[model samples]
Target: MASHLLLMRHAKSSWDDSGLSDHERPLNKRGRRASGLVARTLVARGYAPDVIWSSDAARTLETAKRLIRIIPGAQTVHHNPALYHASANTMLTIMQRESEPGGRLMIMAHNPGMAELYNLITGHYHRFPTGACAVFKRIGKAPWHDPQSWRVVDMVLPRDLEAE
Candidate 1:
């Protein structure tokens, strides 16, 4: 079965103060704008997902919500605490286990892991900035286990949205 995975990095966050926990940090104004633009771009590109999984962090959740707003459906968006600061291996495991048969999956989470996961899946280094997204097309009959089976379909960053 063919499947597509969209991995997104959480939008820019506010760090004006140091007291807040990492999970509690909210998206800054620029983050909000960039996320909206990306959401619109996804809609325009017909990249809506059947399932959405996101980190429990405030910024990540907010980014997912904004993306959902553009899609407009009754799909449930899962908030997984494990995704908050998960490693690439952890993220891959989650994706492999949770992905539905022949369905698109979208995940919103944090850095190094996101970049690492992209590289692992596509076999190419991908620098994921805030609000960046990488789309992978999986063609194997089995689930998303081997990274070599996935192909990088598209990748976009917030700066790329400026040209759209």
Candidate 2:
């Protein structure tokens, strides 16, 4: 059976505090609302992750927490500091080394990496706006390190759900 993989970019962050480091920036008002929308959308689409591997950054952590609140079945959440601004290859490497086998998994982190990783895996370029998720079905018996093994299945974007 194929396993599910979800890649999510952190929700929009607040730029109000110039003194705060990038990692310390919190989710803004729009981010908070968008996170909830994304969470509900995940549940509605039956794509709620079994486990989440997320950046330790404030925005990503808050996003993961929102998901946990709405997704009753969401089980574990791991905060990885290395994922804060990791590259696409780094993200895949970490997942391959850390993720458990045969369950829905999610990665929540910053962009450039998120968008790059999506394009690498799906063979299609996508600009991952804040609070966007790319859902994939990993092909049978293939490892997470293999880009060709993943097939893009669905997407959940905050803008797309604004009317919902």
Candidate 3:
């Protein structure tokens, strides 16, 4: 069976509070709604990530927590500091370190890294807008799946769900 992966960019964060550190920034009103939109979309599609790796930053943490509630099968979400502002290579390394083979994984993270990771996997460079979800199905052997071996099944953007 192919391993499923969802790359989620953190929801919109507040920039109004200059006093708050980037790590402490939380989701804005729009962000909260967007998060819920993504969650509902996942539930509607009957997709629940079995394992999750999320950035320790407040916004990502909130997104992960909120997103999982709609997934009946979702359990633990591993919050790691390294994921906060990880680079493309760093994110790839984190995925490689997973002990569970063929387990569906979800990563809630920040911009450039998320976009870079997606581009690395898809060979298509594009900025990941806030609240965007990129779904990938990895086919064939464990530790063997590369960019070419992965198929992008869906991409859900926050705006795409605005009509809902």
Among these predictions, the greatest lDDT belongs to 2
Candidate 1 per-residue C-alpha lDDT over 40-147 given as tens digits, one digit per residue, 9 for 90 to 100: 877777676667889999999998888888775617689999998888999878867774544667888998899988887777786789999888787766556667
Q: Rate the local accuracy (lDDT) of all candidates.
A: 0.82, 0.89, 0.84
TM-score for each prediction?
Answer: 0.91, 0.95, 0.92
- Lowest lDDT 10-mer window, candidate 1? 95-104
In candidate 3, what are the lDDT values of residues 1-164, reduced to their tens digit? Answer: 43788889999998989999999999999999999889888778755577678999999999898888767778788999999989888887776675654457788899899999899988897779999999888776646335565678889899989976
lDDT of 3: 0.84
Query: In model 1, which runs have C-alpha deviations exceeding 4 angstroms?
Result: 99-102
Tens-place lDDT digits, model 2, residues 44-118: 888889889899999999989988988987887899999999999999788678645557889999989999999
Model 3 segments beyond 4 Å from truth? 142-145
Q: After superposition, how far is residue 63 of candidate 2 from its true place, in Å?
A: 0.7
Deviation from native of the Cα of residue 14 in model 3, angstroms: 1.0
Q: Which candidate is the best by TM-score?
A: 2
Assess candidate 3 and give its TM-score to the true structure. 0.92
Arrange candidates by TM-score, highest first: which order? 2, 3, 1
Give every collision pair in model 3: none
**Backbone clashes under 3 angstroms, per model:** 0, 0, 0
Return the clash pairs for model 2, or none: none
